[model samples]
Target: MDSIDEVLGELPLPPYVTAEDVGFAVKALAVHAAEQWPDGPRCRNDRAPHPCRLHRWGQRVLDQRGLTDRQVQVLIAEQQAPQR
Candidate 1:
């Protein structure tokens, strides 16, 4: 699948992203992160070609939130880290 919502149709973005949206966006980033594949990389969660829809959505959200590359890396690492 390309995204969890694949064929479900796109949802509209909020006029402005709220804290709740950020939380969801972060989760999407974590869950939909890219993965390596024999046929080339794909989304770990969605199994779409790497950097799939949700991934792009997450990136766009992070960018809109003014996160830098380094900050984004930190965010991704934090998301991937095992919980205590």
Candidate 2:
């Protein structure tokens, strides 16, 4: 973990996961997708380590909501789709 991560700790989960929270989680996962770097993978959005705080938080939220991996993939794909 990076210094900032160590200092700040993980993002907190909501007391209750809701559809709106799922939407935000999907957006976070999509936007924070990994990027290949010379050193290694990093967060595409924040340039932090792969699976940065927000990404991990989003995943946890999805998992808590009982979403399967395939479902998460579909959500991410839909989030990434271009608007008409």
- Candidate 2 structure lDDT: 0.94
Clashing pairs in 1: none
Every candidate's lDDT: 0.75, 0.94
The TM-score that candidate 1 achieves is 0.72
Superposed on all Cα atoms, the candidates' RMSDs to the truth, in angstroms, are 3.1, 0.7
- What TM-score fits each model? 0.72, 0.96
Which model scores highest in TM-score?
2
lDDT of 2 by residue, 8-72 (tens): 99999999999999999999999999999998999999999898999999999999999999999
Q: For model 1, how does the per-residue alpha-carbon lDDT over 20-41 read when each residue is reduced to its tens digit?
A: 7777778887887778888988
Worst 10 residues of 2 by lDDT: 75-84
Badly placed stretches (over 4 Å) of model 2 are none
- Give me the displacement of residue 31 in model 1, in angstroms: 1.1
Clash counts for all predictions: 0, 0
